[model samples]
Each structure stands twice: as structure tokens, then as C-alpha cells.
Target: MSSYRIIGLFALLGGLTACERPTPPLAAGQEPAYDLTSYLQEQTARLQQEQPPVLKSVITKGQPTETLQLEELDWEKELAIFQEVDLSRPALRDFYREERHTLPNGSTVSIFTKDAEAAAPVDRLQLTVSPLQKLERLEAVVLEENLLFYSKRNISLTAEPGSGNLNGYRVEGVQKLIFGDSLRYRVDANL
Candidate 1:
């Protein structure tokens, strides 16, 4: 092969190889302000420590119209329901790709995207941890591009993993999903 043709082939191969590599969350010489994964593990353990009262609410158009005391469901069943929507478990976290960023106020934001599952609508999860490793915010969203044309049942639960306080931690869960005929359900709980 001519030198130019050989160079072109090598360039094509390099591009293909680069596409196979997963991007790192941090830039060169940069470290995350908080240990998000470890913090999640700690939160999970704390939530499992005691059975806290769960306040369940249903909201429509950003306003709560219905409220229920979910103590009737019990903690074990409630946690099992939460695990179905929240993939904070380390084993399930393996399926997600993590990225971290440092905010101007010095807090760290860690995002985990489960892009591998094309069928699910809500796959992106984010957690904002304070400089002290305190979870301040948690969010999960459904990327519009990933929305299925037909109907999809996507449930997401949000919770603060572990708080650095004598009062211990709190567990909050949210379940949002679409069933048959495009019916949508939004359920939020604080335990």
C-alpha cells in the first residue's frame, strides 16, 4: 500500500479505538470534592438501621393533592419498593457511568447515567454532595432523546443517603411511572 493510504487506514483504526474507551469523570490532575460512591454506601446502611415513618404524598402539576401515612406499608416492604426504583445499591450502580464536577461554592455533583439500557426512559441519576460529603440534593431524569415512542413505565426514587448529624439520616422515596394507556403515577414518600 502507498504511504498515504496506510496512514489513512491507521487513522480510521485509531478513531474506532477511541470510541471504545469510556471517558473519565475528572479532568487531569483533578479530584472529586466528595467521595460520592462511598457516601451512597454509607447512606444505604443508615437507612437500613431503623424504620422511620414514611409520609406518602401524591402531587399533580407540582402541587400535592393527596397525602397518606405509609406506615401501613411497613419499612421492609417500603424499602423493597424503593429498591425497585432507586438503584443506589453498589451492585446495581455498576451498570451506571459516573461523572463528577466541582461547583463554585465548593460542593461536588456526581452524576450516574445508565445509558446502556435503551428501553428505560428515566436512567440518569445525579447527587449533589456538600464539601463535607453531605448529600444535599438528588435528582433523576428521563432524557428526552431516550424516550420510547410507545408507552414506558419509568419509576424513580430520590433519597438523601447519609447526613452528618446527631439526628441520623432520612429516607425519601419517589415513584413515577407510566402504565398502560399512557397513565402516569407520581408518588413521593419521606421515611
Candidate 2:
């Protein structure tokens, strides 16, 4: 092939391999902040002072995991990062909390818990969300060892491996975690 043709082919390959994302520039006068722990601590304090009722110190025991299907569903898109308060989205009309599970025998169960308990492995707690307006969803967990946040409808949960990497949620050594809307609880291992 001629030199020009060879150059054109290489250019085409380069274009095909490149990926581009249209992320917004950071605020002109602000630096990026990554100390999320401190930020959350501030929010916790504010909640305690301004709305003490919304903040609760809770510890729950899991009933039995033998019958409950502990699964997490995931749905996500590769988009620029944004917050629940960012841009315009549908307003959350009404919201409630519930625990829904499926048994090995294919039976489904739903219970509206007044509060999420830090319970044992048998129960996979969930927030029965009914947002008034549709918008992107999010989930965060504050486990005793480390805190994790995953974008909702994309993060999935799996059975606690006897041991595994952080590739997925493992229940071992996990005592306390916060999931969605300040919902706090613990995961017991014995089921």
C-alpha cells in the first residue's frame, strides 16, 4: 500500500479505538473534593440537630436466610456523574420502606417495615420506593469495615461468599451498613 493509504488506515483504527465522554467541567473556582466520609459525617450531624427523628441508632437481628432470596438487581448507563439534586428531574412524590423476598420454592413475600432493622442474613431488606417523579437512583452502604456506594438500579447483591474480593457484596465481616435514604442495618452471618 502507498504511504498515504497506510497512514489513513492507521488513523481509522485509532479513531475506532478511542472512547470519548462529554463530562462537564468542574466549577470554575472550586477544586475536586474526595473526602466523602467527612462530608457524610457533617450531614449526619446536621440531621441529628435539625431533624433528630429522621436519624436513628439501630441494631437489628436477621431472622433466617434459609428461605429468603438475597439478590440485587442492577441497571446503569455510562453517563457523567450527577447527584439526586443535580439538574431537573421528577420530584419524588411518595416514598415508603418495605422488605420483599422470594423463597426457594418460588413464593414471594412483602412486608412494610416501619424501620429497617440491622438484622440477620435471612432478610434482604429493601426500600419500597415510589418516587413521585422519575429520576436517576442511587444506593450507599456504610459497612463496619468500609463504606461503599453504587448507583441504583445497577448495583446487584449476591450471597455472602465464604470469602471473596470486593468484586461483589460479601456478608462476612460486615456488621453495619447504610443503604438508601439513611436506612441503616446489620447483616448476621448464621442465617
All candidates: TM-score? 0.47, 0.20
* Model 1 agreement with the true structure over 1-191: per-residue lDDT tens digits: 69999999999999998887464344576553334445444545655575455667765445556877643444344434324335444344446667888899887777778767644444766766677767676566653332333422333344443554212222333333334233345556665
How high is the lDDT of residue 146 in model 1? 22
Off by over 4 Å in 1: 1-45, 59-65, 72-99, 112-122, 142-180
Give the poorly placed runs of model 2, Cα more than 4 Å off: 1-9, 16-19, 35-185, 188-191
TM-score of 1: 0.47
lDDT of each: 0.53, 0.28
Clashes of each: 0, 14
Candidate 2, poorest ten consecutive residues by summed lDDT: 73-82
Residue-level lDDT tens digits of model 2 in 1-191: 69999999999988876853334444475322222233234433443444322111223345333323323211121011112111111111111133444446443333322224433111222221112211111223222223554222211222222221112222222222356433323322111
